[model samples]
Target: MLKNSLDCIEETGKGDISIWLTRGNEEDNFNYLNIMDTAKGIYPKQAEKIFESFYSDRKGGTGVGLAYCKMLMKTAGGDIYCKGKFNQFAHFILKFPKID
Candidate 1:
């Protein structure tokens, strides 16, 4: 996903790019997540709506991936979140409580 986002950024030449990877918590054992891009302007707002079913800027997506991810995580006791700018970039966080 990081690679794809970077590729997308490079292709569009729209924003500054960077990636951060953090280890999962010992207590929750959440899946490790990678956050990429320097989301600044519209991306944050865009992200919120992106999770909605049947939503997509591109014609190809049924706009269900993120929404599905959210549902799957909830079923497993986790949550996903995103924040960023419209013109800048965005950050996404997926957290799962440490499972024993």
Candidate 2:
């Protein structure tokens, strides 16, 4: 999802794109999922709404993917969020608890 989202932004040439990826697990902490996106013309706020149902900054998607992801994560005791600066990079993070 993260890659696809980035691809959407990159293909449009709306930003300088780069990705710093990470994944790890701590003994009593959470599993990590991170995707950082450099989108020169994309604001994190705009990206934040990407998850809304039927809302796509661009075209050609039902716009329910991120919403569905949120639902599935909540069902599995996890969550998703984004952090980014306007005309800078956007970071999307999803974390899940380590199951015993």
CA RMSD of all predictions: 3.5, 3.4
Each candidate structure's TM-score, on Cα atoms with residue i matched to residue i, is 0.67, 0.69
After superposition, candidate 2 runs with Cα above 4 Å error: 12-28
lDDT of each: 0.66, 0.68
Clashing pairs for model 2 are 15-40
Candidate 2 lDDT tens digits, 1-100: 6656567577757654444534454553667577666654447568678677787665577778878887888888888777777666677778777766
Worst 10 residues of 1 by lDDT: 33-42
Q: Candidate 1's residue-wise lDDT over 30-68, tens digit each?
A: 764646575233465587896787777754667777778
Relative to the unseen true structure, what is the C-alpha lDDT of residue 74 in candidate 1, on a scale of 0 to 100? 85
| Clashes found in each candidate (C-alpha, N, C closer than 3 A) | 17, 1
